[model samples]
Target chain A: MTATTPAPSAPVAAPEPPVLAAVDVTKHFAVRSAVGARSVVRAVEGATLDLHRGRVVALVGESGSGKTTLARLLAGFYTPTSGEIALEGVPVRQRRGRVERSYHKDVQLIFQDPFGSLNPLHRVRHNLERPLKLHHGVRGKAELDRRVRELLERVALTPAEQYADKFPHELSGGQRQRVVIARALAVEPKVLLGDEPISMLDVSIRLEMLNLLDRLRTEDGLALLYITHDIASARYLCDDVVVMYAGEMVEGGPKEQVIADPQHPYTRLLVESSPDPGRGARDRDALFDADADGLGEPPSLIDPPPGCRFHPRCPFAMDVCRTQAPPRADLGDGRWARCWLHAADRTITQENE
Target chain B: MVTQFVPDTDRPDAGTTSARRADGDVLHVTGLTVEYVTDGDPVRACADVTFTLRRGEILGVAGESGSGKSTLITALTRLQRPPAVTTGGSIVFYPRDGGPAIDLVTATPKALRALRWTSLSIVLQSAMDALNPVMRLGAQFADALRTHDRTLTKDAAWARAAELLATVGISGDRARSYPHELSGGMRQRASIALALACGPELVVMDEPTTAVDVVMQRQILAQVLRLRRTLGFAVVFVTHDLSLLLELADRIAIMYAGRIVELGTARELYDDPRHPYTRGLRDSFPPLHAPLTRLTGIPGTPPDLRRPPSGCPFHPRCPQRFAGCDTDLPELVTKGGHSVACRLHEPTGRPDPVPDPASGPASGPASARTEGGAS
Candidate 1:
């Protein structure tokens, strides 16, 4: 079969299709102080995202952008306060019913810190072994060792023998990251939700880890949801990108569309603010200053700016943005952004006024 | 329990300093050597490192952890302490006020302190440690002001503190806030404001934005750029992220082991990197524009600094290393306006101008490739 050659605005042809979907999901937490009743924290407010086989969908946002909450909702770790998450078109429910068990086996989540995720006292072999045994029902010491080695080798921590016996403390940052990937893969999950896995790594080695993930996505037919705050990394490694500002998907679709031609003011600010010394340092600095002067503090998520959560600090905020929430609209092609500027040759419209 | 580092401060300030430094280069040294006096054996930290920063220009020192980038910055700042001693090397800082040119390596504790916040201030990687946890941001600022000049009263110091915060884009209210109360970005900015609280002419920042995420990093960088424009302070910015260095610095110096392998205008260093090491590093970063390029990582780890490789420190990983590269240490020489320390760029042997494909895909290392007009 010939490879794809679509028009400029057309979606890139995929080797596979969607394997997991979170349809308009929302996860909220109640904050209760020592003497107070309860206050609602909209951890995730109506986030709809998808994970496709053999491709990567990057979920980009800064801290407190509802990324982790969204990840948990998809992983079945938290029941959505509203909305639904489906794996292969099946809604995620808590009970360990046979189908739910199988679904859990097929969709695994990769956490950011390996040190924090893994049990410190347990050896590497035991950590990888327990997951395989509980989910797959593998037994016998010999068979368990073989299965453990196979999992480690799959993640490229080669010789497997050397890494199998060591504890989490003994491994390097890159090795530890690989172990986390291996444990997640031990269940043979079809969809891998990587939540800022590379954000904690050394600059020189993070790319290597990302490429390994990219290889698994394309070669092994795995779907990846790489969650990160670095838009630059998201653009590089993801086929599609979603920019989340204050619990809503502000701009999303193909990575190229979102990064190269950002529609939302916040997305534009993120992409432009990065320092690229080679681009006439003076010019980049001037641009940085110009943008910084306008960006106030990130708003309180508890009491978000009425219309769009970003209205309070937006460089171009209209009165309307504070009163009413704007709808997510088509930003040409398959891409969508939730901002008034992209709404019908619209002037910077804010919901408040 | 502690040592004193003051040298001399009797010299009076003569008008503007950058204009009088005879212009070529102020901190001039050739074949400078430095080593760390570890318990058992001395560790060679910097060997034959040489470079020149013009009177008022910023020179970024780039390298990863243990790359000796921090040592170079600390050496310039006169803060290299215990175990780490300057085995050999001279850092001649041309004092602008008609004072005698001083050797930073031998400066006294008192003199160094006077030169410190007034002449050269350093903002370290840890914003938390740099600022006092217990003190109010206002008090800390006032303390710096009072230490520099005993004549300034509390009222004058407090007034200056507010002005400095405003200069750094922080509001007057922030002066009352403690370091912990402010966001990470705010704390970093406040620390920078305190560094500038004394009106230093030169600032050496070691991985200034290392801990913060990219967004905050960019904001902090923007503040630094604005501060430079307003205060006219020359900076020696050090960072491990080369991709970041591509945009914020005027000139960049790529360090490997203990010496600069490549040094040039930011554009030249990123677009046309000559050293094999530079090419290797450029390969490690995923470009912001490309969606599918598989970032090719340099296969092995950086060599152990204590037992550094012979010839070139990068020779261990150079994909195109030649026979002579293994035994001969290359010197940084200028060619086509860019200074590079690679045998390949020397006007000898074949003219190999082929760009390193390993750095990126067919269309890669897009350094300065995107002329962003986002404003």
Candidate 2:
């Protein structure tokens, strides 16, 4: 059955490789427990993702699901305990001097908090110019000022001069975020890793920020990794969706397929739990009852449950599920999920349909 | 327009009379105004907010961060600290035993103390802040339960505490764990269980589920609904997420610039919102099931309340605003059970034709997408 399924999109004539990719990446942090016992928090384990130019892949998960950890690994902030991080088909190495600086110039990370990202003492122009000078080494005040204004305009901060001179404290949350984006664009990076970029902004302006990111992707051919807990917003802006549970990637595919017909129990729970006002009370009541019985909190990373991380809370937990991790079951059209229910020998089409 | 403000002493029976008229009203707040007395001119955080919460009904107060929804909650519970004062308003509570109504604003400290846990309880956003960090979950619940009921023994209180925790889906044995030992979702559920330890008539939850994940948020909300159904306690759930309120709330009040701009049944607000601000807020959330489309959110930021817009606070950002919107302040007047404060809804204010729903700037992308089908 795996051999019968066609290759993902049958890339006509060898498609261009992803701008950035994490192959089987894992990160673990050592911490002391309440009793002073040493423990390891397995933040991310064997997570693989590829960010193609002009494409947005949303990393959707709960608070401690290690989506952010995967992003940080890709950003070169933390060296992976295992596996590899490749940029433009070249493996990235952990080093200081010029190689690391060059990697930063190619990939820029937009932090969640706009207020803290910028230097409070400097003007917006200074913040934007520092990157251009350090990364691109563009000398002369005239060139730097021009590039700074252009960056601001690219982010839709109108009358660039007005915003260029203002301090971080003077701008609104949305405006400050725009400045943050402008600073990221200063280096003309190939990949933008947004870590919950719009979560801190007001609800009304969040869409605008998403739209801006979308524009950047289309116009600049920049690959984007949008990390957010909001499934609806992810569906709105992301072309592909990746569902993570307990520091492991569970299911991933085209946004529509994954969101509309989730294969994994955890992914299904996430899609069902997202607030959809269009649902009637009767439907929600049934959903609530089903959720109340089976739903449990994400497991602790330090001593995660053996076998399937989600088996403890999964309604379809089988004997094998509690003893061993499930293998990845490939569904056609770039859809795949890690679940025993979708094992190759089992009939997938009839069950999923 | 400037009528003489009368103190609560003048209308001692106002609560009873209103409660009798409404019959099922658990809380009646009239002319609720809260202000922050700063060095400069005082800023009114909640201006003339008025609403009635029905018995066993979930009333959701939706607003942005600085839109004063939190201030309204604090003022309603009489938890506002110094500098934040309830300048004008009366919160009349109708006791379940059919006793005389007590005006919370004018009630003495001793009278308020008598009503604390037995009549009302609160759940804050941060469960760690509400729960005792160093104490066990069961002990905290016992403290609240025993303090309210002196007749109950320590063993009985502890048993009741375990039972309450069980109601919220936490195991009885887990109640012995401290707040830090539990997960974020468990701690939040524990705080909720503590709030209900006394079997209070009304629960004031301020973003109780905001700190948890969406899956856990659904569980917490479902538990609240189940508990409310069994116990028959009213709820005033406040959150900045309007979409969450649409599903959880029986009635929703949309606030902007320190005022209740619109109030109606959740269905009414969802299907056909009367106020422009309400419409914008409803459209702000992207639908999970609908075909994805470009959504143009409300263009501008909420006005700074210290120097709010001249007339209608929402006019500056309102796409459908007209000549009269900036000159005359519209009052929140009810028509056909739905209340809206906007010039477009006011009959005498203007005869301007309503903008075509399909032609509005925000309507293009929204109408292009199909309605979300049943899950």
Candidate 3:
């Protein structure tokens, strides 16, 4: 796939059609301030990405970076103020009743908090069976019973009978998370959107969930859009990586390239800041202070900084960076970055590196 | 009273004067047990926990949800509300400025009020609730300060509050604004500043950085460490992130099912973990610098504290569990400063057993693998 083909803008040669694609998707919300002044919060600004079948694309960013807003946009929960989200090359339209049911079946979202997502009042069997009946019309006591047990077993919640009768509060954190995953899979969605799925889980059991997601991608051929702030886990579970800073896609490419050789300054700081114990005897005090004066907190979305939204925190801001937005710089071989430092016309200075 | 299992050898921190009890020991917790007095049954939230905090040293408590990390902190500070009761053990606070060691568990209400902010303080997990929404940041700081030291004038308290806010990298002027006006990072910084208002000898922080972004989390931790070094105070940093503790803490205690499963220095646990659960936790998260490899996740869930496992709490999910692990409880044995309570690390049969640090995926132990291959 890495033939190093030359292109002026955009990467990825489109080896296969995207199962789900967002073309320059933008979502804005009008928020009223304490002063009664109306302003539009540019939560997601013109972000474009694609999810290919059987592949995992990770959306990496800090809080208020609009990564969650982007996922919600893809889930058809929010209508894009500007662009559009398409599934299998067809634009998704808002409809009533059963018409939206098929679209919901095609795309499923797994939330971060397992405890809040599941219903505390209902038993585990009902949680899985409700989705199955609503989506697939699997009726009758026997049919519902079989499908419910199968869903539980699919998520490795066994013995299935024991877990099926128990309430959500009775299950462990890991077990509850598994049940959530099972409910998501009950609909048999081709595109699975998970927002920080394992962040709330324990370290000892986080890998189990990741491996389960990876297996689902291979066996069920599901396309995954994994969103997380943890860079190491993204590289571990994903094939492609997208780095977003303040509602803008800064750098993205194959997971290895983005993680191994990060181009954007923000991406570099994120990779360096993620704690890794195996690195051995690092002078941490000095390392923490090195980036102290580099970048400020994420700018306000209602009135974000002009030009490159990251310029305020970006260590290598320039006059042009303050004045104009940077174009996507094509690094070829499916690798690209959105920073003025990588612009072809700009003269590369020592400060840029 | 619960039967306490103390480490059976001399600690590695015994040599340094800073590690000695007479000079630098700030807090000593022994056989601490806490239970939630529910209608059905008393649930053991924390059991038989023991550890020592040295002056200016950061002791991290790492565990998953339901592991009683939060319960331990709440009980140690004598802040447990109704429905939660400390059933056993004691917490002794050794004051640094030539004061008698006070027992927190049995202290009188008057003594506790005197000790609240002057000698001990807490940085609550959520920064939002830590400050009153109706009160301004300056007022919050001033309230804590004046409550402890009524002799200080209001003007003097405000001045100190401003100075403390500045110490945590927030502007002194922002203290006049209400909590809602400030950003999350600023509010968290203010809460930290409020915690340091009285210059307590020991600060108990419960996931202070979990609410913010990674960049801000690192910044807050760096600020905390800097403040600790300058103020000469110890810290009990509690969080679910073991990886973060690798760089932040001098010593770490890994908790599982209400018990401290392993206690050791950061380097010792990271390099040569003796407990299977500790090894599982170490390998669970992928390292940023290391080559990409499949991780081995520990299967099963944390035991129900109400009816915890009979032997080692981690035995059911342990990848290398043997007969003794499920039946006979392993006492915590000390090797230098690192203490582990697993059958493999027990000194009964094996004088020297090779620890498999390699994170193999769901595949059992090396012996099990070889046996399977031969069969």
- Taking chain B only, the TM-score of every model is 0.86, 0.92, 0.89
Candidate 2 residues B1-375, lDDT tens each? 111112233433433344343457677787889999999999999998777778888889999878999999999899999799999877888888877787888787788888887889999999999988889888888888878888989898888988988898898988789999898998999898888888888999999988899999988888988888899999999999998888878889999999999888887788788787888788788878755556778898988888888889999999988887888889887776688898887878767677647422124254442212223
Q: Note the DockQ of each predicted structure.
A: 0.39, 0.54, 0.46
Candidate 1: deviation at residue B164, Å? 0.4
Task: Name the runs in model 3 displaced over 4 angstroms.
Answer: A1-14, A290-294, A344-353, B1-21, B349-375
Report the C-alpha lDDT of model 1 over A1-353, residue by residue, as the tens digit: 11111213323334333588887777778898669978888777877776777777889887888988888777777889888777776767664678667877888888888779888999999889988898999999999999989888888888999999999998877788899999999898989998999877766678778878977976787988999987767766777788888787787876776787788988887777654332432566455664565476566677777887888878778876777677666654457778776765743323221
State the local distance difference test value for candidate 2.
Answer: 0.84
Give the range where candidate 3 chain B is weakest over 10 consecutive residues by summed lDDT: B366-375
Best by lDDT: 2
Better of 1 and 2 by DockQ: 2
lDDT of 3 by residue, B131-198 (tens): 99999888888899888887989898888888998888887888898999988988888898898889
Model 3 DockQ (Cα-based): 0.46
- 2 or 3: which has the higher DockQ? 2
Q: Residue by residue across A90-194, what tens digits does model 3's lDDT show?
A: 888774577578888999999999999999999999899988989898999999999988888888888999999999998877789999999999999989999
TM-score of chain A of each: 0.90, 0.93, 0.92
Predicted model with the maximum TM-score: 2
